[model samples]
Target: MTRQELRHKLQQVRRNLPAEQQLAAAFQVADKLEQRLESFVPQETTVAVYKSFAGELPTSPIIERLWQLGFKTVLPVLHPFAKGHLLFLSYTSKTPMTINKYGIEEPELNAQNVMPLSEVQVLLMPLVGFDHQGNRLGMGGGYYDRTLAQWHNGNRPNLSPIGLSYNEQQVESIPVESWDIPLPEIITPAKHWRF
Candidate 1:
C-alpha cells in the first residue's frame, strides 16, 4: 500500500480502539518513557513533545510524568512566521492554549516560553505508523520531517528524536523518501524499539 493509504488505515484503527485500550496505552507508554529516559535526561532539561490528537497515543500522562520527575516539558506550537515549521513552547498546566488551523490544540504563542531546538534533549514525536527499522510515517504535513532534517544533517547532534506509537501502528516496511528521517528510538505500549 502507498504511504497515504497506510496512514489512513492506521489512523482509522487507532480511532476505532476502545476507550479502555486507549487509557491503557497512555499509561503503558509513560511507564516505558520513565524507565528508558529518566536515567539519561537530567532534571530541568527541556523535552519537546506534542499534544495528542486524532486518536494518536495520549500524551497527557507522559507530560505529567516529566513534570513529576522535575523535567521541563515543551509542546510544539505552529510557527506564526514560518509557514510550515514549528516552534517549541514551554508547556505547563497553566500554559494558555489555542486551536490552530488544523483544529489541534497548541500552546498559545509566547516569546518568553519558546524553547530552542538546541536546548531540547529529547523530542517525543507523534506518528501515524512505523516499522521495525524505525521508519516513521507522519501525518503527511512534513512538519516533523523538516524539523528532524536538521538533526539528520548533523545540525543538532545531541538531540534524541523519539517517536511515540501504538502496537497497532507497526507495519512490515515503509518506503522511505529522501527527507524521511528514521527515529533513533520509539516507545510503544508493548516495547521500546531502538535503531
Candidate 2:
C-alpha cells in the first residue's frame, strides 16, 4: 500500500484501540525498549529523549530508568520557525517545564544548551508509525526529519537513532521523502526491526 493508505489504516487501528488496551500496549512496548536499551550501557554522557504525548510511543519509564542509571537525559525544545531544529535541555524530575505550541511538555528555556548531536550517545525517537525498513511517520510536524538532516550534514559523531512505537503501528512500507531520516532500529511491543 501507499504511504497515505498505510497511514489511514494505522489511524483506523489506533482509533479502534480502547483506552485500557492502548495503555497496555504502551507499557508492553516500553518494556521491550527498556530491556534492549538496558543492554547497551550508554557511553556518551548525554542522551536525547522525547517526551510522550497523545498517540506517541511512551518513554517515561525508560527516562526514569536512565536517570537512575546515571545517564544524563536531555529533551527537545521546539523552535518556532524550524520544523526540526531542537534545543537539548537537561531533564530531571524537578526541572521546571512549560507546554510548547504543540502542547508537548518541555524543559524550561533557561536550561543551558550543552553539546550538540555529536555529543549525544543515543536518541530515543518517538513516532506515530513506522515500517519494517525503519522509516517513521511522525505527527506531520517534520521536526525530527529536519533535525536529523542537520545532524547528518554537520558530520556529527555516530549516534544511534531508534524509533519507538506500538506493534499495531507497524506497516509494510512508508513513503520516504528526500530529507527524511532513517532509523537504525525500530522497537515495538512485539519485536525489534533492524534496518
Candidate 2: which stretches are off by over 4 Å? 1-12, 39-44, 80-84, 111-115, 151-154
lDDT of 2 at 87: 73
In the range 44-161, model 1's lDDT, one tens digit per residue, is: 4788989899999998888888888888888998899998899999998999999999989999888999999999989999999999999999999999998998899999998989
What C-alpha RMSD separates each model from the true structure? 1.0, 2.6
The runs of at least 3 residues in candidate 1 whose Cα sits more than 4 Å from the true structure, single-residue gaps closed, are: none
Q: Which lDDT values do the candidates have, in the order given?
A: 0.91, 0.75
Model number with the top TM-score: 1
Cα TM-score per model? 0.97, 0.84
Clashing pairs in 1: none
lDDT score, candidate 1, position 66: 87
List model 2 lDDT by residue over 173-192, tens digit each. 78888878878788777787
* lDDT measured at residue 187 in model 1 versus the true structure, 0 to 100: 93
